[model samples]
Target: MGMEFVDLFNQWASSYDDTVAGKDPEYREVFEGYEEMLERLANLSKSPVMEFGVGTANLTRKMIEQNKVVLGVEPSSEMRRIAKVKCPEAAIYDGNFLEYPSLLTPIRSIISSFAFHHLTSDEKREALQKFREHLEDDGEVIFIDTLFKDEAHKQALIQDAEKQGFLNLARDLQEEYYPYLEDIKEIFVEEAFEVTFEQLNKYAWLIQARKGE
Candidate 1:
């Protein structure tokens, strides 16, 4: 198995919500800026929203008040199972981002939390294309993930991981993610979506891309 995403999540699901989002992380601070970004993307009176990877109800808990309806889509069965506890009222889907119109209710913003990076480069491009096709001209896509400084920086993270039980896990994850981000950033720039790169602690890259008509 490349990485048992389901099993990894299953191990963390019960306490995942509290550890990742509930506590004060840079991501939580990033949430503070999203409403301002809503104004930049689509200043709509009412627009349905979707979270492609709503992990442990992290960002959803913050965004619930902004959008009329928040649809959370998570592929991890463990995450899906626990999401109900974090966000009982918000609609939860035990699947990945569904193209079905019934699943997405005319969304203005499609956002995810540390989830998009789990895909491969080809998957990233394909997913970005899908995001473009689904979004309206003015709609926006928000992707939150990690961006390392360089190979040495990544090695440093792996070195640090040695002290933790998940040293190999961290190494494997870094192997999976770091290569494609630069290419992805270029793609975003070419797509006419204003891209500003920022460091959100260890796990950075809060990308905001609006569909330009």
Candidate 2:
């Protein structure tokens, strides 16, 4: 199932930046917030940073401007090609976060936007453990993605989408792997990571967590 998306995104990589933003005006607003969050994270740290699933290098470009030593882990070759064009100085690697070499030690911050859902709950926990190992003692992990409180909340979102005359979007939502909020919190707690969450919308949020002492 996940491999399917890799191929799909690879095919879409060429025109991804323009099409995704041009398809809807709302996406532009979401991307603005996404960029804002990345900029804030960049300002928070002067150390090395890593971005997981860096599609088209949207945030990578921002980190480059902040002068942070940035590395990007991207699964799709086509996407990495685009990311290179977008941020040539960034060290883009060909792998997912779970399989990343972890050669960069004491990484100050590891971040992902709208890409964490590619992992299942168990996979998410596994990836988080790997991220923790690669991070500095007080390093942070930030995720901005589709997040919901529970199944009921997800259903409510579907209903809201239908009310807005977006049945196709609702259908897509039903099949998506939006991470459950409490489940992610449990992983953070179990991993001894201090966590904070900021809601971006009814269906998306930004989560910032740090390894606890």
Candidate 3:
């Protein structure tokens, strides 16, 4: 991750939870059913998990509540500080998706939420390859994030944001590496993973993938 994103997240650390809780009208739709999405992701995950971009530890808290052993990696120090306070039992480290501390145990489930879009398509692929290296043979990779059905769908969303006069949201849509569904699937397949997607809301999709036998 770049220093700009780290700084951006560091700045967002204090109010990031509020934004996800519907406090920001522009992003409310993006985070609608936020708790449900986190809960579902937690439920789908297995113990000895490694979570990338574990911002604020919201999902980490859920996993810990379920008695899952979790190791969280985050790029922003502020986010890590907040997450550590929120999820003291889980070991949260300083790292990004493509680079993180080594795990002692083979991770049974690798997970994340609302953070993968920070990575470009190639970065995402590299992260997936690294995940495959760390996961147990039958382990899964689960994430809930903003993903579009296709390029046209992504463009439509940007247009809608602009039409609604949400310049920030529109700019986010245009600037972020929010990926196309087909592209994500192709990367997973090429990386030898069988993947599936379930739409949780208009903006977020739950992606569950496992290594191909």
Candidate 4:
């Protein structure tokens, strides 16, 4: 699955930004909101920032524009190439979140958009633990992805997509796995990370978590 996704994103790397611009209104809105949040976070701190699975470095470009120090961890070479062109000033690492070492210790904040849902629930927990281990004293990790309460909610999304005549998209959604809301919350509790979940819609959410002092 990992290698397949790497190949898929690599294939889509060139057209990734354009494809994002042409997405349906709902998904576009989520990206727009994510951009706003990324900008705000960049403006709020001058500390080092890292983006996991930064395909094309869309948000990382925004941070670079604000004069923030940024690092991008991307497993796809093609995606990393585009991201380098887009955010040449930022550092780019070749790896995924779960396996990547702490390239920058005491990072101010870790951010990922639309990429984290690729991880399974256990992987998510492991990734979060890694985030905590690499964070600064007051650091946080922000995730923006498709987060659902359970399988029922995901099924509803698939049904709605099919009803709207997006059969292929619905099928893709069916194949993708999303972390359960309750399970994520429980993991946060067990990890002692103070987490806040902001639901953007039935399918999208923003998770902001900070390690306890």
Kindly list the per-residue Cα lDDT of model 2 for residues 1-213, writing each as its tens digit: 144469877987887677545455434433455546656656664458888888899888887898888888999999998899878889999889578765736788888777887777777888888888888988999878787788898888788777877775687577756777898889888888899888875556888899886
lDDT of 4 by residue, 4-121 (tens): 5788888888777765664655345335555566565456544588888888888888878877788778999999999888778889888897777557356888888788878777
Model 3 lDDT at residue 135: 90
Q: Pick the candidate with the highest lDDT.
A: 3
Preferred candidate (lDDT higher): 3 or 4? 3
The C-alpha stretches of model 4 lying farther than 4 A from their native spots are 1-3, 23-34, 37-46, 101-104
The list of candidate 3 runs beyond 4 A from truth reads: 1-3
Off by over 4 Å in 1: 1-4, 21-46, 97-104, 163-169, 179-181, 190-192
Estimate, for each residue in 70-152, the C-alpha lDDT of model 3 and write its tens digit. Answer: 99999999999999988889999898898788789898999999888888888888988898899999999999999999988
Q: What clash count goes with each model? A: 0, 0, 0, 0
lDDT of 3 at 110: 90
Cα lDDT of candidate 4 equals 0.75
Pairs of residues clashing in candidate 3 = none
lDDT of 3 at 35: 95
Query: Which of candidates 1 and 3 reaches a greater TM-score?
Result: 3
Candidate 2 lDDT score at position 204: 65
Cα lDDT, all candidates: 0.62, 0.77, 0.90, 0.75
